[model samples]
Target chain A: MDDPRPTSGPVPPRRPSGRLEESKGPLVEPSAGASASGPHEQPGLGHLLANCEGQELQPGLHAALEVCRPNTADLDDPALAEVQAALAADAGLRRRLASLQQFDQALVAALRDVRAPAGLEDRLLKAVSALAHSEGVEPLVEVEAALLAPSSDAASASCVPPASAEADHAACRDEAGYTSVRSGCLAPDTVLPSKRRAMRLSSRPMVLAASLVLVVGAGLVIWQYRRPASLPTPQQLANEATGQFQQDLSEGDGMPASKKWPAQVPASFPQLRLPQGTKWRTCRLVNVSAVMFDVTQAGVKGALYVVRAREVARGAQVPNTPSRVVFTQGVSRTMWRQGDYLCVLIVEGDEQALRRLLRPVPPVT
Target chain B: MVQDKPQDGIAELVARYHRELFAYAYRLTGRAADAEDLTQQTFLAACAAYHSLRDARCARGWLYAILRSQYLKQFSRARRLVINEDPTELEQIPEELPYEPDFDQELLQQALDRLPAEFKVVVLMFYFEGCSYKEIAEQLKLPPGTVMSRLARAKQRLRDALLHTGQPAFNGSMEAGVPQVVREGTPHVGG
Candidate 1:
């Protein structure tokens, strides 16, 4: 059979191209753009060959070796074998290969030692400083610090610093929104947004159905927080089990009959002395068990419920449950001039009226 | 994006990536002056597009992208300006050197420098960076198969170049009187 293309039998080693770059081939570029006399004017060192074991080595001769030799992973293993054999055929190829190896070694060393050039670190720092100055990017330090520390409900005893522009800014911002200064004097502002967010939050009720599950979760978190979670000593375990005896008194089926809850309830609290016009009175307080206490607060004749804490946790998913208000002794709901506060209206009748009258005050410091 | 603030702070990224970007731009434009212009243009582009960058860690890639666009824009303008002019771009070569490199290396460099702008970067990236065919493809946005074929062909051109020259000493060898190839009938030993 005859073929149009030429035959091959240890043909002279040929370097297909001298380019080390991935750009389109440079052969035509030399002829049309650079070489005045043209490509064929001088013969090329196309290939080097050596025969051994009926297999001939054919090492190519060109700068193309820069890209193909040394570091190039041998993808075409057989072809590379031929290349290596052919390379050995020429004493010059062997020498050049050695030189190329050195070059490669140097390159590897350089790459390994890559550094932000001389003064690069300083320059980078300077850039950061300049960007900070120009952009006024707030350092996240304060936010991060606040996140790490437990929120303190106790009032600060330290003297307040003189108000600066930041303080003035806060004051201006306080008045800028729908925030009201008087009790029941202002309409509710747009506090929340779009229907989508509300819908997403509605999925939690399914998870909260089992009182046992909630109680166990609360107990585990308390155990972990109040004490290190290292393996408890036998004595410690016995002590804990003994301490929980009073709580076990309210046991009811799979669900503990106790009324323990997790994650503090969000209650509208005194932003500023819960407007003086508001009245406050003790509703009631009673221990349902060692672990659970129930309390209700009654607002003074005119006041609204306003309780304040230093921090609040964002709400998350929980199970749905029926809401029932119980009239009890010692818990007092305070009255406020504005905004929603927690209201748990319990069982009605004479017990409810008496519960409002018996509401207890928050313990004084 | 450019909220009013002190101007001196941001001058750091300028100092850090600026000079290196200039060198990269030089390689890109094949001329020093245009490289400098590209460098300055990159900083401006960085300033203009700073807000769009979400990850500060990506600043290098982002800067490179900006430089690339700047190169393309400038290159187009250059093509338009040079349309009727046969301006020799040889001045892009450095004027002097402390020690003369070998003539072969010089010839190779000359041949490489003379290549069209498109081919030069491919060669630089391949040889200097030792990028893989796939990596080259990704950087140049070309197919990998094309990269392999192009590299093979590039080697062939070099082979032809060295073989055609025919000067034993000049044809990729410097030791005089030393034959590069083993002749068929050579003395096997020191008998």
Candidate 2:
């Protein structure tokens, strides 16, 4: 077969200074006084002449040189078919590729020694086990049992009317193995089936009336004394949002695409750049009208919540710059309003770390 | 087969990818303890959120994304702010260096550590993880062009570091002068 490769070109003379100059063409001359023993050096100019045979094979050579070995698919690319063909036909190009491959192999080999510490796998397994235990799906029986359990508070007990004797008997018999409460009206040892049933039926209405008044009185007292369900604080809201976002990600819903704030919104939100090593995980529309961005750094998790000023509670004060709000142990919330969005960042760390995580937002011009 | 059971699936994932994830974590954090923690957290988070993983094929990238995210969340506060080198200065690096096949692993690590985070990540994902430019770009949420440029620049810096290994100018910790650079710039946060 006729050799499709370009014919070998003349070699440039070796520099006398013993320093190699950058070669403009594929025909490179060995530096003067270069060690003959080195693997990269060729024996003579004949080898150099053998390598570069075409009009400016330098581009192809350079392109082939830039290709990483793992990107092997690129070698087959039609756009690089000429380069690939040349590489196959030319011994010198083949040698250079081989040398680069060797370099990559050596680099990989060097890095291969940095393995995970012993027992890391075990520790990780334990963590997974712990997580499983915490988040495992509850069995139906356990869920049902929890639902059936009577209120422990004495006040609540007064509010709950006693079950009918026959109903209690059926429940006790059916759930004998698991039932914690039998209706208080029936004793387990009572054997007078019909006669006791008649007496229980006769006393049921009076007992029910007395129970109703006690329930009503207890309800009134409890209602008067009970504290109103307080609204979730901003910190709590942030925590909930983070949890939901993670849940969404894990469930394969993926993150919602980030959209710019609506034009009608009056406030300018800070375009805070995340610190190095931190990445944008996902942005979600949350709380009906807010945007939540969940970000993670070095195993630490944080979330940024952006809500409109109108959406925020009336008289709610959000700082214009990052300010630390310690919500609970091991978590901190940072809140600031920029533009129309009340931005809050909830992170799992101390206040100092939270402050560091919340880089100062540049003013919107 | 284990994928049918969530716990078993997580265990399988941990068993398979822990070492690779840990190695990447070590490269990113440059500390064994932090790397271990990052790996552990990734798996735990995976376990907790595995229910949401709709595609089994995406498990590897998802794990990696989690690990990277966790690393960022944990260490963002501690990261030393670095002024990126001017593109012109980076372009001045020699295109090629004399091939030295016998370099120490520690020396290579030191060189890798000296690279900026963005560049280092691309290099690690490309060379060590065998990720293609597109894969790396997807993982890091960067444009493929940016990933390629970063990889190219990183390789040049590594070559330079390797060629100049014995000099004190490049030796010692690259982190020592970081505080000064950080002090010079106002920290801005957004992503």
Which one is best on DockQ?
Answer: 2
TM-score for chain B of each model, two decimals: 0.54, 0.72
Q: Where does model 2 exceed 4 Å of error?
A: A1-64, A78-95, A135-365, B54-58, B76-100, B167-191
Clashes within 3 Å, all models in order: 73, 27
Q: TM per model?
A: 0.30, 0.42
Could you give candidate 1's per-residue lDDT for residues A211-315 as a string of tens digits? 568989999899766543333322232233222322322341121222433223332232222222222332111211111122222432211211211111113
The true-versus-predicted C-alpha distance at residue A64 of model 2, in Å, is: 7.3
True-structure RMSD for candidate 1? 27.0
Q: B1-191 in candidate 1: lDDT tens per residue?
A: 22233223235445435544544554455443455455544544455344444443334434554565456444633432211122111121112110101223222333433444444445444543344444455555556555554554443333233333453212222222334432232222110
The sequence of per-residue lDDT tens digits that candidate 2 reaches over residues A1-365 is 11122212211111111122223223222333223544335332223223333435633244234444532455665545666776666655544444444446545544543444445566667656655664232222123212221221111112122133422222122212111211111111212222332234335556767889999999988865452223334444566665664565457555435454434433333445454333233343334366555454556666666666544444455667875475554566767777666677766676766666666655779
TM-score of chain A of 2: 0.28
